[model samples]
Target: MKSNLVHKVVGSQYPLWRTVLLIIVLILGLGQTYVSTHFYLLYNKANSQHHDVHHEYYISVTKPINTVASMSNPNANGFTNAEIKNIQNQDFVDRVGAFNPTLFRIVIEPPKGMGHQDFRTLLFLESLPNAFLDVDTTNFKWKEGDKYVPAIIPRSYLDLYNFGFAQSQGMPQVTEGMIKLFVFNLEVKGPKGSHKLQGKVVGFSDRINTLLTPESFVNWGNETLGSVSKSELPEQLLLKLKNPLSSDIGSFFEENQYEISKSDGAKAALTNLINYSSFYVWLNGIIVCALSIIILLLVVYLSIASSKTEIMQLFFLGYGVGKIALPFQKIAAIKLLMAAFISLPIGAVVAGMIVKNSAQLVPFNSAGFQLQLLLVFGALVLLICALVVLLIKVRIKRLSV
Candidate 1:
């Protein structure tokens, strides 16, 4: 008697109105997820494009020419630690590091026969922390009697030397590759003593316009041959900004009376703007997801309740709550799977269209979306299915006896 009633009750459920309503709700929920994900993905793609083109570039901080120091310190020409601390707290600034300037004079002894008479040149050697270096410092080992000082020079400095200095002196213009090809020797004479050092042009900086040495080598060299005339404060600083193009950033520097020079022209600023805008799309997507989940809960409840008589009959016939909930769980799972499958391609197509329209502005591959998005979509589908199944089980347990 109970088995026939259970089958009849289960088979009799034809809640056409509830089905129609839930189908509409599912479409809206899926649409929300797609819109949110697509917007954020566009921003990600744009930012990636900027990085690929300007990977070797950065912006620099400078003091106004002929501007006297606000405070009376020897390193007044550059920013002080207090000012730097404030700058680091800003959202527009991405990275910040400094160069340690030598307090005393440096006289270099170039290799014999290769150098023409510029040995007494007062050279300035600055040290930046190892973290900021982009090149491989694996061979930058400095030891007693074997001082092989790996060096990084500004590309502009090399260009000036090759074009202006070499032209005036009637020397051949040397390419960047050629400088790294040769091993060179140098002698540095300080107030304490003179030491022989090997110099190799390992890399170039597009951001900082200074001769850079590893921080380890600088700490050791300063202790050994440094003069007592100067302190440890840096004269110039290099800034890595997150959004150099922001109006607030530009205004902040101008108000502080600081100078800004960018190696990547105006590209960094534009990329930051796109990031900010895309973030809003992500937030809207979140709102849509919240609404969709609510709708899903209501839809699951109605579907299960419509078949309540059959479910209760099964329970009285010694059916487990899990078994009674299984059919409703299956329905919810199927709907969720359908929603995800339909939403993902639609989102991808929309994103591709946008990318296509913006091809001139932000160049991307012809393939529209990233594989990571597909993984995230799969996770979303599973999560929704699991939640709906749990919802059905809970309702089944509550309704029994």
Candidate 2:
């Protein structure tokens, strides 16, 4: 009997009109979840595709010589063997100090377990850079082993080398670095067997440069011909430049000058992956928020218009109609808050997955999952708070006396 009375009170107090509003709110909340999840999924898919596109070619630059000039200490100033090989004076117009050849060589030394073929797959997926590989076949001739595999990037890669010469040293600067670098597609024979590989010039700063490749520098030899030893490589050669080019810089090298390993469709998809997903996330948020507001307003208007009799009776029964109306305002605020909360995590998870998969699928280094999670969670909380406040202000004004 008590249950029936409770039901009757609920039915008459809310009526079909208010009940329908509650149902609509629930649907909208769920719909927000669905949209947020799918948006993230779609964003991840798009980001992955873009990353694939940009990673087709791998590249790197080497300073065959190392020259360290100490301004503070004269005794420490001297040219190392690396300086002699890499830093050319103004004499060699085609060298590093010359007209800023954006295109350079990126040599790879594969590890023991990895073969040339496997390495190549990894390289291709990494979006091979505009560099070449010097396969040392000297052992093959000397010990009846394989010959040195030669992969030469065309002069076109050179054209892409944009580091402008320092008027004095003629070395390229990251501020004026080439928009694109060389892609070196080469094959090597590890202890196990032969493997194909590629790398890209994802970063370059100062005289030092960095290449993203599947091939590790472990088990490398002293011969500077094929690949540089891991110790020889700097810790941070490919640091981000403060001044990057704004334009869509094209390849620096000429097309016919060098032959690059063919790029697969998957390799070419990474070009604009992250950028596009970011844009989409922002756009989706804007659209969803706008739609939520409109839906809330419509629901409130209908609830007020249709439930006049029920509301009046409640007022007569010693109930403060305004207080009862407070729930409607609360529901609207909750709807907006929940939708915003849902969207942020969904977008962040999608971004993190995309970035993580990107590092695995390609050769780039993505931030940790924890960082992405924190960022996403923070964004969601902030958005929820902001939306709740806005909804409260809007809904409170519509409450009838």
Candidate 3:
């Protein structure tokens, strides 16, 4: 019976409590890393394409302007230099461009074949850089001898004429291409003097409103006819956001009481989702790590207690604590190292399977370089195993032989 008991005690594996806790810790470690990594990759992939994460919208400050004359520097628009700089510095904005106001007044004579009587309209013109213009500018070029000033009008004007003016006046609705062929005379007046120039519509824009001309044409027209600008700054600014759903962009506008032209109201929600998921993943890791440490301590204590008889016998036989403790230390180190080694490949395979399946659902170009993911997981495993082995060594030394 004594010999049987000795064999039974020596052959015993980890107790049920230790085994269950070890499994839980192992699962948590693998799961936390894999889940966090998947979300991280998804977030990066979403941000990388950036074809159109959000819809196109316009932003401007909202100050009181009761009347045309009540506006603060209406001729210069409401945007100040400091305000422009503040907007441009925002991380969400991809680019910002301001409208260049025509220093001249324009008198429009009715189209040649449109009406029988004398009809005229007074208007102003604004222009932006060619890159911002959506129209084909091949024929929009200019020379001193050119008769017609090529103009790219807004699509809103077409909608108005189609649904409002033409319907009310019993006139035929016109198409964009047809309108481009219709020529009208512009009596452009500036501080220098007035000149009559023929102008024609070349194309229409979906975003920009008001009459738009070439930047070169506007500069030449302003220099030749219009008086020098009273204010150097532009009257209207065009802000292009890099990410439409950015919370920073929305918050800034709200805090400043700025007006937005259009908002999809989706950016803030998406960003919040990413942030919340990240926060939860971190919280889970922290909790699991704490629990793992506690379980490790308990396991160490229970293991030492189980072998107390043999350990004490060794001490009484002229053997040192170091000699008896060495086996337990080696066991602890080997178990942890093996777990780390096994878990690394398992975690990697799980991550790969998830990414591959996700690609099938919504295809994306796989990353050619994933050294960051490998390095991060490898370093974490190395660090955790190293710390656990060191702790095991210390615990073994403290065991009373």
Candidate 4:
């Protein structure tokens, strides 16, 4: 058959070394492309899901405090309705919640026999919506008739007591479980009347600073026990952001003379560090793939140049340029297909290894690994094969002429 004669001619023209070199470069380019794409998707998913974490995208905003000036009018440090509206309209903000502080006075009396028999101090409680809280809120709700109140205190409070107070006073350090077991009496005093309620610590938070109770509790306390008018505005605001790295955050806060805590700033800095590192990894993989592509093209050119004389003879014998180029085109297509197929298992194994090793430091989800890898690399191999086939046809046509 005509095909058999063409194959014999083409097979003799390509040397063993050149064929081997071509296969190696194709594998190199395709494998690099697959691996890089896999990690890019992995980190991109991580970036999108990070907002769900408490300390990453949510930050508390407050005006700068002037203690002497705030004594007469505490509302001076609070945000006006206009200011709140402006922040809500900004492109970076997703949602905003205010910290509603209790308007009444409260004194906490610890359970007896805990070695602090005479410890009683005025305590302040603030409430935010349950959606903003990081802890489980099933047990955090309160009704008007409930005798017991559940509270969430800051983790830093316990750390300060254990590391600083306990160590300094030579007292025993208490754990979270122990704190939750201790019941206290909350003596709420106001112009209306004085009421005693039982309270207990239910959870701890690292994001919010003050002691927190259910929003329902705070509203009920302000209505029943608080002496102050209900017109008091909130002094602090919590903002959920769409993108924490947006320039609008710093500019808007600076222009309004608002301040964010040190912990929020640290979280933003850490996020920036991670984003930059991922970008560099993706760039390096791109460079390697590009270099491999160039090497593969060089081998193709050399193979055609060596067979130029035979191609011219075949053209003079009435064979078409298309027929003469078919064998070389088939070689490129088969090798590219081989590379694409082989890289799948290899890439999955490498990605699995990476996810396993970094599980503790970073959570990497490899959920759609095979499907995405297949679609991305399938298109890449097809594009490269079409390019290589076109290159062979053009070079052979020129040689035959």
TM-score of each: 0.61, 0.33, 0.52, 0.74
> Which 10-residue window in model 3 sums to the lowest lDDT?
51-60
Where is model 2 more than 4 Å wrong at Cα? 1-270, 307-325, 333-401
- Who is ahead in TM-score, 1 or 3? 1
Q: Give residue 2's lDDT in candidate 2 (0 to 100).
A: 35
Q: Rank order by TM-score, top first? A: 4, 1, 3, 2
Per-residue lDDT tens digits of candidate 4, residues 1-401? 88778877765766788767766776676677777777776777766755444235777888899877687676878889899989999998888889988999889988777767899989989999887787777789899878689999999999999999999999999999999888898988887877889898989886788899998988888888765544388889998777777877888899989997757765855676677667777777767766776676677667777777777778889999899989877876787688667766776677678766655566656577567767767776787778878987887888876
Where is model 2 poorest over a 10-residue stretch in terms of lDDT?
Answer: 235-244
Tens digit per residue, CA lDDT, model 3, 371-401? 6666665676567666666665566456552
Name the best candidate (by TM-score).
4
Best by lDDT: 4
Q: Which residue runs does candidate 1 get wrong by more than 4 Å? A: 1-21, 31-75, 78-97, 102-124, 141-149, 155-177, 183-198, 206-209, 214-233, 238-287, 304-320, 354-375
Q: Kindly give the number of clashing pairs for every candidate.
A: 4, 77, 3, 0
Deviation in Å, model 4, residue 249 alpha carbon: 2.0
Candidate 3 clashing pairs, residues 3+ apart or interchain = 76-235, 77-235, 245-267
**What TM-score number comes out for model 4?**
0.74
What lDDT is obtained when candidate 2 is compared to the true structure? 0.38
> Which one wins by TM-score: 2 or 3?
3
The Cα error of candidate 1 at residue 207, in Å, is 5.1
